[model samples]
Target chain A: MKRRDFITATALAAAFGLAGKPVYNVLASKDALASKTGKRLAMVIDLKKFEGNSEMMNKCVDACHSMHNVPDIEGAKEEVKWIWPEPFEHAFLEQNNQFIPENIQNNPILIMCNHCDNPPCVGVCPPKATWKRAEDGVVMMDWHRCIGCRYCMAACPYGSRSFNWRDPRPKIKNITANFPTRSKGVVEKCTFCDERIVKGLEPACVVASKMYEPEAMVFGDLNDDKSNIRKILSENYSIRRKPELSTQPEVYYLI
Target chain B: MLDKIFTGGKKYWAWMIFLSSIIGAGTLAYLHQYEVGLGVTGMGRDVTWAFYISQLTFFVGVAASAVMVVLPYYLHDYKKFGKITILGEFLAIGAVIMCMTFVFVDMGQPLRVVNMFLHPQLTSPMFWDSVSLMGYLVLNIVISRVVLNAERNGVKPPKWIKPVIYTSIPWAVSIHTVTAFLYCGLAARPFWMSAIMAPRFLATAFAAGPALLIIICFVLRKVSKFDVGKDAIQKLAVIAAYAMFANIFFLALEFFTAYYSGMHHHTQHFQLLYVGLEGNSSLVPWMWTSTVLAAISLYILINPNTRKNEKILGFGAIAVFLSIWMDKGMGLIIAGLVPNPLGYVVDYTPTLIELTISAGIFALGALIISALYKSVLTIRRQV
Candidate 1:
């Protein structure tokens, strides 16, 4: 091609690249828009429902893991857990009673990020990589901002946060093209399924659990008393993990 | 200044080579760690920090201990410490540099350490720790240089050095207090959540820091034409004795409160250290050994007869040094993390690579200290 023609072609490419996507386009692709007024996202898990339905629980775990591309490494030493089972006694040790029923004590219950009103994890972070969203109560992690210091993991009382010890990409069983894979060293956990919640969809785990057992998982806005989670929590008395710490955990477990 | 370090005897060269080889090995280990990830170390999701942080904590005390000598000599005009004040300040310089290195090496994304400055979080004690430590480092470097230069030229130090020297006293205290705050403020770990952690840190620091100086002065006495003075050594021993008393007393208070109150969470950490929680007593042997060694050192230090015997005092000083190292570096650090947030006895033993990297950091600090000390010694000789 002639030099003049080549110049024109390069100029055309630069103009397209520079003006291609506006700020709105980038924000549109991001997770969770400002939550609706008077709506605070919360979840209620029925402890009774998980009994002898371990496979169903595994499915819920897999759905969230697969959805988020959480690593599938073996061994508890370097496990990167998002959502998993914890024995009732260990999960609520502060509230444990000797006279409590054996079934509740022996059985394991599903647990994840509480998305506390006052997140201690956010408080300790030297960089504000993890923060509580203003619109909703969900504690969110900005992957780009994280220095992978793991102070957040230490500050989290419930052991919700997980660090990418090694390159998580290799261990991720199903390379889900839909989600971004995390680099090694960054902290990650349940973002309260912010991406899906913003899209007006329930979390992957909730959707997966509903398929096998609808009564097992409930997720909705806690501010709306009529919402499914609020309704369930209101009817059946529920307990939160380490409530005395005043983290004001949004995740509740219904007996 | 550089020529003095280069013009060393056979022993000095051997020492440099030994430190260098360890540093070289450590650098290789760090390279491998940087290539892979922190997973190469024993650190996991449960015990997120272990060896690196513990080393940083130990050295922060080492760095802060400089103020003990600095404050006495500079602020209070304790002239006995005049001969050794530069020694303490120079040691702080080397220690702060190592502290910074350990923090850097511990990072998952070490390259992103600049983020601490770029987007600083004022609420984080870690931010203040970095600030105070770096500030104290500069304070020492300036004060030591001014004094050493003034001495070499047969003149008084600049007028400005007095206030800067004064600032270093509290600045030194702040660095360790901020480091203590790093653990104490963590509401999650019951072991480190006490108000006394900062005091505990200071107490242990005072004992360990001067105990180390006692040994270093002895080494200096033998090696060079210069002597740090017998009076300075004895005075530091007295300071160390009082400090160790406070350290042991503070530890006893921790035990008393935990056992007497019978708070399950509080007692659990002690159980983990002493008896081993849930059949995992890996730290039991180490803690008991440290306790025994500490007792022996205290006995030697507190007694009037043994304190007068420099040979016995040297032995006690070494004991105190190792005792504090075990307590600060191993026992205290891992104890808070073992019974992790979820009641898991997740043990953390630094991998070979981690050990090498840590050794490398120690060697690096020794190299810096030795080089700086050599320059100072030469400068003193010329005067």
Candidate 2:
């Protein structure tokens, strides 16, 4: 073709391409829009509902572990846990009291990854294997990329992360086909059920807790003021693990 | 030059054989660790870093301590240190190699370590540490090779090597400081989150590094009739003495801050190391042993008459070397992880496989130093 005719044709094509970009974006799905302007997901655990209730706590723990294929190793040193329970005193070290009632003091408090707004683990990772997702504020681990240096484990103040010291495949009692089981020599942790949330479903632990006691575990977007987590957090006196460190944990405990 | 390693005497061959055996054993243990995973070691979910990382920390100091000699000779034109500056540089090369090896062994996925360079995170102190250590290693190797070759040929070194030698001085300091930042920047572990960590590391490094050099000098003189001169030994002793003093003083400052402030988080680690926390006193004996050795070393090093005696000076050097090794290598890293994040005390003791692997790395360092020193002696004899 002649040079002038080619130039005119290119201009027409460029104009159409520019015009088509906005049209394509405008027709994008709702999920894509939600991801672009993401919500700050948070969780609220009602201490009154879970306190001294080991069965309910275990149910939540089992639901998370079974769904995620967390290894049920025998020893404490090599054990892998997604969600577990700690005594009230241990959970709230800053608020420990000598005069508190024994039952309340020894009560089991459900604990998992705080999914902090500013995660030190994400910062210390040499390979950027662990990072805080900008969309939902959930700290994530890329098992394939982790070199298993354990710097993230050391940096996590809440002990939320677990290392697969051995091949975890053999230890997983009932493997879930939906979620992937991590290999040995990688750090794994609670993902805030990113997979479930993306499917418009609540976290496994939250759904499990709701079966026994409604609203015992609440999960929602903290940015949405109308969400149950925001409403509960504002109405109740809540505390977080090691707030003085200023990790700004998203998980709150309503006492 | 590489052929000199194979041209050693009977005693040299025997020593090499011994080191090779240990290396062989260590290699076997490491293979097992690789097969079975890190679970074969004592490291747990709570105490993720222990013997391997601690040794890495200790050896980084040794590598950096080459600056103690390099700065005095090249900067101040100190004639006494001229004879031994090559020795110090070669020692740094060996220590840096060991540092890299320890890091490699501690990794859960040793093969994937290339990802560190592939997807480098500038924010991580570990990334900076790897960069500084590799740079320092290359600097020492180039300086030592060029300068020593010049000496063997009866000529001055090339002009470009002077700036490279000078760059090594600050570069040495950066390696240790960056290693310290690896631990100190972690807000989670309050035990390592101290401002004085870098200074304390430098102080102990200057002491331990020269102390080991003094012992090596004595051994070289007796075995190979290689006299590095009395003045060099005395000067090194004095440097070691002052560095030990600074180390103790810095440690005292740590004690005061931990105890006087009366904060549980700050004091708990000290309590665990010194006095045994909650009836778990696994580390108390080792800490006290280090303390006693440090005290004895200081007492002998400070007295002029005792420091003047060659026989006693060797003992003092050994004392200081062992003391700092125990403190930095065995105590510091483990104590920081005890009484883990959630107020649970889970003590860690290195498994046999772990110890074997560490022993192999130490033997490798010794083997490198032995081979390099042998070459130096052979070249000097020809001159």
Candidate 3:
């Protein structure tokens, strides 16, 4: 071939390569879009609002459990729960004291996955079955990929994760068709209700709490200073469980 | 060479049959666990890892202890260990097989284990552990095969084998160290999150490994009229003694740090293991038994007169092996998980099925060791 023809052919090939968008570039552009939204989702639980309302707390638990299809297994050893009530002393050991106020001491605090910024569960999962979403700071689990090693359960300092000890399908009282139920031998936890968030809905528990008391549970983006969670955190004194562990828990409790 | 294992005497066949029965029982129990789930064991959400993980931890130490023999034989050119080096290597091959089997049976989804290789998360210590354990297993198998074949043929091993043998010394240490990191790296469990964890694991491994080897040597001497020499046994006893001392020293350091600092998170686990915490005292008796055994074994091991007596040395070795097993294999995992991350104490005891499955794995290890040793003895007899 002539030298001019060879040069022209090479130029045409390079143009096609540049023009036709590679798959990775498209992926990179999608990641860029995720960062553009750049949400750091967070939740703030106002314990004072939940002080005398055990009924309201139960409603929140039921809503989350029913929405997520969490099994109703009996006994603490084999029990699986997404959100549950724990005594104040058990939930916050660092804050326990002999002279604690009667109201605070008597009330059971609500607890769930903190969805940490630096989650140890994500770090310890051997199969990369669980990871923290870069787009939103919510830690997520892939039930199919989890080999059921339970390393994530051991790594979670909050006791937020649970394993399906038996077939969950039989245990489910009423399986939600929209949300998938996990099979036996996989770890499951709250994803900060990523499915609900994607559909522009607040987490079930947050929405449930709104009926009885608007300030009971607050969920919003921490990245946006104007967000409700950020506003609540800034105005009131709040604390997190095991904050010294440096996991940077996204969940806060308003005292 | 492999045919020698099939040609053993009546006693050998009886032992093989004994192990086979246990293995058969274990396989049946494991099938139940497979059809159901890990719930068949005593492991719950709180105490998520129990007997199986502890066995994995214990056997990794046993496997890594092969270094004690290999290092002295090759690195220092200690001719005393020459006769027994192959024994140590074979023992390692058996222990590693047990380690891998324990990991396999403990998984909830045993079939999905290939995901570890397919996905390969570098950040996870479990990933690094699988890599190191697999590497160590391959290294020991290659080194033992080459050296044993050379011995059988009355020739030196190929020049290429020297480097591989040398690589195995540190590789052995890496296997156990990585196993220790699997626990110690977790900041959530204060019982395991200590700087001394790796060193403590090595100390215990060196002690338990040699102690078990000495007992095996004694059995071989009685059963097959195979002696690895008086000097080798004495040397192994001394190695075990020093390692036990280091292990005790590390335990003392942990106790001091926990008590003196008076950190609730740190001291609570120790308190729970030693005494009952919140009415949970299931582990207290076990921990005390381990402590008493350690004390008795240390007394027997440290005295020169007692150490030189092969009869007493055998007892000391058994005591040492059992003591460390109780401490590391039984107490370590339970203490770490109980009083869990939330300071909730949940007692755990392995169910019948769990114990049966574990017994099967132990039988499998014995079967492997017996076959390997039989082959080695057959070769030595020809010489």
Worst 10 residues of 2 chain B by lDDT: B1-10
Displacement of the residue B36 alpha carbon in candidate 1, Å: 1.4
The runs of at least 3 residues in candidate 2 whose Cα sits more than 4 Å from the true structure, single-residue gaps closed, are A1-37
Backbone clash pairs for candidate 2 read none
> Model 1: which residue pairs collide?
none
| Candidate 1 TM-score on chain B | 0.98
Taking the tens digit of each residue's C-alpha lDDT, what string does model 1 give over A8-74?
Answer: 9999998888877764586676333334574688888888888878888989999999989998889
Which residues of candidate 1, in runs, are more than 4 Å off? A1-38
What is every candidate's C-alpha DockQ against the true complex, given to 2 decimals?
A: 0.48, 0.61, 0.60
**Per-candidate TM-score against the hidden true structure:** 0.92, 0.93, 0.94
Candidate 3 per-residue C-alpha lDDT over B101-152 given as tens digits, one digit per residue, 9 for 90 to 100 = 9999988788888988898789999999989988988998999899989888
Best by lDDT: 3
Q: Candidate 3 on A80-114: residue-level lDDT in tens? A: 98899999889998779889999899999999999
Which has the better lDDT: candidate 2, or candidate 3? 3
lDDT of 2 at B184: 93
Note the clash tally of each candidate.
0, 0, 0
